[model samples]
Target: MTQKAKSRQEIAEEFGISAKTLSRWILKEKLQIPQGLISPKDQELIYEKFGKAISK
Candidate 1:
């Protein structure tokens, strides 16, 4: 089965951050993330750099 792609907002939500903050973080870190749905590889890199989102 194919996995559903995740959007920036979804990722930000997962990280407990706002989409704007995620954008800032990406800029600060100089990550080469594309617009729209995030790829699996980029997702992994994001998690690695920022760590997994904390569950409440």
Candidate 2:
């Protein structure tokens, strides 16, 4: 089975953050988050670690 790939917009929406802010966080925090071609498992991990910051 194949998995669907997520776009930056989708990821941002999932975390309730703007795409620009998400971009900045990637560079500023040096997050393990991948922009394109990310595996579902890894993306979930990134969200688990970084999604909380979006609320603050």
Candidate 3:
């Protein structure tokens, strides 16, 4: 199963947070974020660290 890559903004909105906050979290955790989109692996890591995005 392949997961589509997501943009930082998309992920942040899903998590009910600002992209800036997400950046802070990423920096705090020292996670690597790709240039354009968040890879499936990194997306999973974010989901694990911060629960999956809130259901709309």
TM-score of each: 0.84, 0.58, 0.83
Model 2 residue pairs with clashes = none
Model with the higher lDDT, candidate 1 or 2: 1
Q: Put down candidate 3 lDDT per residue, 1-56, tens digits, no spaces.
A: 22789888988999888999999998899877766788888898888888777745
Which lDDT tens digits does candidate 1 get at residues 1-56? 11567888888998888999998999899999999898888887788899887634
lDDT of 2 by residue, 2-49 (tens): 156666666677678788876886678676766575566756655666
* Top TM-score prediction, candidate number: 1
Give each model's clash number. Answer: 0, 0, 0
Ranking by lDDT: 3, 1, 2
Cα TM-score of candidate 1: 0.84
Order the candidates by TM-score, highest first.
1, 3, 2
**32: Cα error in model 1, Å:** 0.4
- The C-alpha stretches of model 3 lying farther than 4 A from their native spots are none
lDDT accuracy of residue 47 in candidate 3: 88
